[model samples]
Target: MDLSCSDQSDHPSRRRALAVATGLAAGALLPPAAATPSAAAPATGPAGAAAASYTNPVIWQDFADLDVIRVGDTYYASASTMHYSPGAPVLRSYDLVNWEIAGHSVPVLDFGAKYDLNGARGYVRGIWASSLAYRPSNRTFYWLGQIDFARTYIYTATAVEGPWNRLTTLSTPYYDAGLLVDTDDTLYVAYGNTTIHVAQLSPDGRTQVRTQQVFTTPSSVGTLEGSRFYKINGQYYIFLTRPANGQYILKSSSGPFGPYTMRQVLLDLPGPIPGGGVPHQGGLVRTQNGAWYYLAFVDAYPGGRVPALAPVSWTSDGWPVVQLVNGAWGTSYPSPAVPPPPRQVTPMTGVDTFDGTTLSPRWEWNHNPDNTKWSAGNGLTLRTATVTDDLYGARNTLTHRIQGPTSTATVQLDHSAMRDGDRAGLALLRDSSAWIGLKRDGGVTRVVMVSGLTMDGNWNTTGTGTDLASAPVSGSRIWLRANADIRPGGPRPGRFSYSTDGITFTRLGPDFSLGNDWRFFMGYRFALFNHATRALGGAVRVTRFELSTP
Candidate 1:
């Protein structure tokens, strides 16, 4: 990691100018290219490519309470968790333009018996909107993730994926705290929920010396929670969630923590809905093109809210404001279109006979993961481990990541050659509380659904009780089709189905809306599942996985 903040001139040749002119342009951070007609096209490649920019939020899957920060050559972000383990899930990006879940903060926050987060049992015990900061001098990253008032701990690591050191454990009533370091290397820890407060940290980046300063009079600006402060030029801008009403910002000078004043509201609302308003938490990243942009989450009503990015411009008065029109807000800007999706298609190997030695990233898990639950041998063998009561326990679960709305992943599972209680199928999981998947029980292939905020099986079926072998031999190949379909009311509910053969799929269950707008849940996520209740290890063979847009 280079500590040298070289002069902008050294990197001038590679940096492009903003093609479109704007008042708050960061200057030379964006490319000088003009906005192309394809600017409206949806993004398909890694983050940062102009082709990935959208007039609206492109990756709309529910990733709630998001806090993003740039760390060295990568941008790291995390959000609230309903099922993801290790407390908070962390995402990394190279140019702040592209982002991927590198891992989690405190990778394996091995709580063991200290916390038991069963479906309904452990609702929100996990961490929420956590703030990220990078200490360049030591090349260490700091994260302050709070799991409500019960416990609030800070951790640090040299690399995102690391042997993180758990630091001070303070009983402060602060929840959702953000960490910031200034040009002078001074550290400030700030939190906002009911009130906004900042405390100075010891020079070593550990321990608080002075009492927290109540920076702002607690103002209910709607979804105002994820507070982040950034310095542009000389002015310090305080950004926080405005809840459902939209995000708002405050400005200050003199120092990082400040006697800041309200500048401008960053987001407005669409007419009125059943819910009063919908706001989201987001962070700002300055592109190399010299454009200052803000990325935040927006509640798309009952459809659930996900992360979105918009441009932030400054007014003539030096006040920062979110661009708006007719009192409504959106995610567009007069700028060069994002580039096209990358042409490289690094396809997964077609050989998935799972000799029990290999696992693809396409395979996922619910809640937390236990490496011992499965093994790759001569074939893919999944053995059930000790879990509390339901599937979320350390055992009996296999999962995968959600590719896209129009994508499909097909796998060949030969259950006929297996034993009972050994279920191998596909699923889309968010947390332990809810998930819908397909499992082969004995000779009957069934669609297993779990919802209602508990790990209870509210839905399940057994191929009409008839022998599945009697039907057309769809072969051992199973197709897991996941796609979004807009109903008559405009709600784009994501549907998951499976086929014995890749050609014809049987609609396994009713449509489950993709987003998690429902209170007390993180955004939506899709994953594959392979679990077993067998005494001896059983093998589920998958021949291949083909992912493609419809």
Candidate 2:
């Protein structure tokens, strides 16, 4: 591989001007473009679009905690799903700017009965960081993810979009793991946070044969994790993220288990951005034209951490440097050298009609859903299960990511079949969540807006909201909507409203300021929830769920 370096000077005033022009705050690297909520519309095209240039946070939506790999010009990205069923979402991209959900590594995370909605739960616990690798020798795709802090499993498939096979589950849990297939076809896994380790896998890639400590970061580094191991040009490289110090790269010419040399490739340089956090925990890929670029994420909430693309230039001494403009990461750079295919970029946020035989790829259950209690036929039907009053603990709460800067989501619910003590509606899901929906109490149907806090430390709602808004309703059908204004450098807040006509919406609850709680470690998502407060036999059907951003 040929690596070249070029030096370009940047001016501070010009950098600030560029940030303002791109709708990003002076210190914030990439902020969501201010949008006006409207009806669901067609996706315009690829984000960061220009005739010759594109912007950072290439992916405007939330596909956080990502790892990307390239095989023959096509790039595949895998992201953390964390308790969401059909976990470990894999996406495919051509230009590294536009992406679409290709598939998921697992159909359902049934590591134990808890993931299956049993007595126990896996909230904030399912699949974390995963490594997606391809082995050319036998033409197989492999995915490794840690579960329950005790098990790490390897899944394999002959194709990227697959009917994957669970090859084996390793007894040792490797946190934030990275998988590498060396030039000799030997397999290695690098993992851990404070002290990183490299371990060789058995010939079958099932168990660990031998392990050794390769490198350790200082306490000053501050939460180093997400190790990505790669072998290029006979040299071994490991990429690690230190949110306080930026991203670090370790290189070893000796071997995979290395006495490596470490360098801070990208630093949290001084900048004027609003939400200032380092770019870290991503993968690197050499483009079709031999140009290298790093795919990483920045801590931008309440939209959650979003991906960013930056150019990489290698020095004559074989060290890679993450390029910056005027002491900060560039907001816009030239597009990659390869030409993207003739396809319209699909919007990750949109409407789901529930008319199809299966659920849309955009939807994911809070956990492994009880399939017997849910179906997509005339409309999306969710049967109430025995659970607490909180939406977090309730099973079959279908969810979708909240779009950035500004957006609105609306859902039409048919509660004709709802039983007494049944609650169903639209919600903004997080550690602290709020909803506006229909509730049946004392044989009376009413429209209510409620908020709850996860006080037990397990995401189970303790009790009903302190401020409850309720009004009697005469019908079995209702419309609920949530408007989220999550622009950076401002209060990230959301509001809930209800409508009987679906045209005019009445605000029901106070504006809820979204929280960036570290426990969930995810963006606030819009969810459709139906749960039983007393007994089971309650159900709701959703006819239309529309998401729009201006």
Indicate the TM-score of model 1.
0.72
What is the C-alpha local distance difference test score of each model?
Answer: 0.47, 0.70
In TM-score terms, which candidate is top? 2
- Predictions: Cα RMSD each: 9.7, 9.1
lDDT of 1 by residue, 1-550 (tens): 1010000000122121110000011211122222211222333344333453334443433455566655433456655553355555556554333455555665544444323323333433455556566766677867665553455567788777655678766656345566666656776665655356766678985567664555554444422445665555555656655444445566677665677776446444542122213333566555433344555555443333455556556555565455544654554434322334343322322234455464433333444555665566555545544422234443435443343333444554555544456444544443323343445455665545444323322212111111121122334545555554312135656555666656787665556654332343443444444555554455555555454455
Runs in model 2 deviating more than 4 A are 1-50, 218-223, 270-273, 456-460
Q: 195-270 in candidate 2: lDDT tens per residue?
A: 8888889989988999899888776665456677876656677777654336677889999889898888776553
Task: Give the C-alpha miss distance for residue 505 in model 2, angstroms.
Answer: 1.6
Q: For candidate 2, list the clashing residue pairs, or say none.
A: 26-272, 26-273, 27-272, 27-273, 27-274, 28-273, 28-274
For all predicted structures, in order, the TM-scores are 0.72, 0.88
